[model samples]
Target: MLRVIGKRLLLLVPTMIGLSILLFAWVRALPGGPAVALLGEKATPEAIERVNELYGFDRPWYEQYFIWAGRLLQGDFGTSIQTSRPVVDEFMRRFPATLELSFLALIIAVGIGVPLGYFAARRYGKVSDHASVILSLVGITIPVFFLAFILKFIFAVKLGWLPSDGRQSPRIDATHPTGFYVWDGIITGEFDAAWNAIVHLILPAVALATIPLAIIVRITRASVLEVQNADFVRTGKGKGVAPRTLRTRFIMRNALLPVVTTIGLQAGLLISGAVLTETVFAFPGIGSFLATAIFQRDFPVLQGFIIFIALAYALINLIVDVSYTLIDPRVRVQ
Candidate 1:
C-alpha cells in the first residue's frame, strides 16, 4: 500500500509539469494579451510596450515560462494582475468558503443519495424504485444555474425563508478569523452568527448537491443490485442471516467501491467547479474568482487557480485510492 501510494505521489511530478506547460501555453494563446486587457485599446503604443515590459511579457514565451516555473517552484504564485496582491494570499481568502460549501454539498449528497439508492435497490421493480429513478433523472437533467435561481426565488424571494445571496447577512456582526464563517462563528461563541451562516448556506449547497446526488444515487443503486446477486450474498441468505444484517454486512459492504469513487470525484468537482452555481447565487468562491480572472485576462490568477485545481484533484484521487483498501480488503494495489 505504501509503495502504491509512493508511486501515485511520484506520478504527480510529471503530471504537474505537463499541466503547467499546457496552462502556460493555453493562457498565452488567448486572444488578448495582458497589456490590452489591462490598458484600454486607446492606450498609446509606448504605454502598451511599458506594460508588457513591466510584466516581462516582452520576453520570449519560453523565457517567460521558465521564469514563472522557477518562481512557482520556490512557492511564489506571483501577483494577481487585477488585484495587485499575491495570488496565494487571495486564494487563501477565497478558498475556505468554496471548501465549506463543497464539503456540505458532498455530505448532503452522500447522506441522502446512499440510503435512497439502497432503499430503491431493496425495492427493485416496485413504485419506490421507479420513483427514485425518475428523481435521479430529473436531478441530473436540471441545469445548476436554473435550479439555483428557482431555489433562490422560492426560498429567498417569495417565501423569505433564506437569504438570496452572499455568505452571511449584512446586518450580522461577525469576524471570520479562519475565513470559514460557520466554524469561526461557532468557535467564537457567536451562535447567532453560526446559525446565520448555515441558513445562508442552505440554498447554494442544496443546488450544488443536486447533480452529485443524482450520480451517487445511480451508482449506489447499480452497485447494490449487482452485489445483492453475488454468490456470497446468496450464501449469507441461505445461512438464515437476518435481513438487515445480511444487507449491511454482505451486500452494502461489497457495493461500496463504485459509490465511493463517485463520491470522491463529485467532491473534487464541487470543490473546483461551482462557478455557475456560485454566479447565480452570488456566492463568493474561487469559482467566481476564476471566472472573473478569465474575462479580465488575468493570466497569473488563471494559471495559479488551475494549478491549485490540479493539485486538489490529485490529492482527492490519492485519498480515494487509499480508501479502497479500507473499504474492501480484497482490493489490492500491485
Candidate 2:
C-alpha cells in the first residue's frame, strides 16, 4: 500500500506540471493580458508598459512562467491583479465555502442516489426501476444554472422561505473568524446565522448535486444489477439467506467498487459545477472568485485557479486509487 501511494505521488508531479503548462499557455493566449483588462482602452501605452513591468508581464513568457512557478513552489501564488490580494490568501478565504457547499451537495447526492439505485436494481424491470431511470435521466438532462434559477424562484421568490441569494444574512454578526460562516456561526452560538446559511445553501447544493446524483444512480444500478446475478449471489440465495442480507452483504460489497470510483470522479466535478451555481446564487466561493478573475482577465488568478482545480481532481483520483485496496482486497495483491 505504501509503495502504491509512493508511485501515485510520483505520477502526480508530471501530471501537475503538464496541467500548469497547458493552463498557463491557454490563459496567456487569451485576447487581453491583465494590464489591458485592468487599464482599459483609454489607458496610455506608457501606463500599460508600467503595469506590465510591475506585474512582470513585460518579461518573456518563459521567464514569467518560471517566476510564477517559483513563487508557487515557495507557497506564494502571486497577487491578484484585480484585488491586489495574494492569490493564495483570496483562494483560502473562499475555498472553505465552496468545500462546504460541495460536501453538502455530495452528501445529498449519495443519500438519494445510493438507495434509489439499490432499489432500482432489486426491482429491476418493474415500475420502481422505471421511475428511477426516468428520474436519473431528467436529473442529467437539466442544466445546473437553469435548475438553480428555477429553485431560487420557487423556494426564495415565490414561497419566500429562503433568501434569494448570497451566503448569509447581513444582519448576522460575523465576529467569528473561521472561513466557514455556517460552522463559525454554530460555534459562536449564532443559530439564526447558521440557519440562514443552510437555507441559502439548499437550492445551490441541489443544483450542483443533480448531475452527480444521476451519474451515481445509473452507475450504482448497473453495478448492482451485474453483481446480483453473480455465482456468489446465486449461492447466497440458494442457501436461504434473507433477500435483503444477500443483496446488502453479498451483492452490495462487490457493487460498491464501481460506485466508489464514480463518487470519486464526481467529487472533482463538485467545485467545477459550483461555478455557475455560485454565480447565480451570489455565493462567495472559489467558483465565484474564479468567475470574477476570468472577467477581469487576471491571468495569475486564472492560472492559479486552474492549477488548483487540476490538483484537486488529481488528488481525488489518487485518494480513490489508494482506497481500492480497502474496497477490494484483490487490489493489494497486485
CA lDDT of every candidate: 0.93, 0.88
Model 2 C-alpha lDDT per residue in residues 95-213, reported as the tens digit of each score: 98899899999999999999899889989999999999999999999999999999999999999977878888887776557878789778988888888788878888988999999
C-alpha RMSD of each candidate structure in angstroms: 1.2, 1.4
Error of 1 at 32 (Å): 1.3
> Model 2, stretches more than 4 Å misplaced?
none
Tens-place lDDT digits, model 1, residues 1-334: 8888999999999999999999999999999878888898788899989999999999999999999999999999999999999999989988998998999999999999999999999999999999999999999999999999999999999999999988999999998899999999999999899999899889999999999999999999999999999998899889999999997889998899999999989989998879988888888989889888988899999999889988998899899989999888788733
The pairs that clash in candidate 2 are: none
Model 2, global lDDT = 0.88
Instruction: Give candidate 2's error at residue 147 in angstroms.
Output: 0.8
